[model samples]
Target: MLRHEFHPGKLVAGLSLLTVAVVYAGDAGGAWEAPWFVALPLVMAGLLLAGVAATIHGIRPRGAARPEGGPQGSGKLGD
Candidate 1:
């Protein structure tokens, strides 16, 4: 099995940008009507959420610290 890691903030930002592109494309192609007020606010909200997520993620420590003051290498998969 393979593991994947991603920053929630970056994901949100990227999705927001993609959505903005979609809105613009749709409007340009006359596929649907996207009011500037709604689209702009949606983009803004996405950016704001991303920024908040990034700030929270930045302040936290990386991976879990090893168990404290117990036994060495006891937590390994193989005993």
Candidate 2:
């Protein structure tokens, strides 16, 4: 199972930027206006979602670290 400390600060920052871009885009009135207003939020949301997925995937426990001396299965030459 995977375990991760979920952090929302970065997501919030992205959302804030997205909001600003949306408002700026909204002020520019034209046929191309609404799509531009929406583009930033969509891109920001995708990036943040991908980051969250990566963090969750990375935290899964695999196994113990290797022993210090050498490989585990190799028998001594003259035991």
Candidate 3:
């Protein structure tokens, strides 16, 4: 098994999302608020952060590389 190095980008992205979540949670019931407002931002931020973290980790030296012609495989409609 290959061991991967810890990626600072991933850590930073995760921590940033966590910070955003905490901040939003704390101010969830302020005067300027609407249904799903807080939840939407939080979810979006979480997803963005997760994507950043995943990208960082996924590209690490020991991680799996994208298959030949890109993520969809062989660049073909039906492979």
Candidate topping lDDT: 1
Ten residues in a row with the worst lDDT in model 3?
59-68
* Candidate 3: residue pairs that collide: none
* Candidate maximizing TM-score: 1
TM-score of every candidate relative to the true structure? 0.60, 0.38, 0.35
Angstrom error at residue 68, model 1: 14
Assess each prediction's global lDDT (C-alpha) against the native: 0.80, 0.60, 0.64
RMSD of every prediction: 5.0, 9.7, 11.4
lDDT of 1 by residue, 7-71 (tens): 88999999998888899899989999988776778789999999998888777554333454446
| Model 3 segments more than 4 A misplaced | 1-35, 62-79
Whichever of 2 and 3 has more lDDT, that candidate is 3
Report how far off residue 4 is in candidate 3 (Å): 14
TM-score of 1: 0.60
- What residue runs in model 1 are displaced by over 4 Å at the alpha carbon? 1-5, 56-74, 77-79
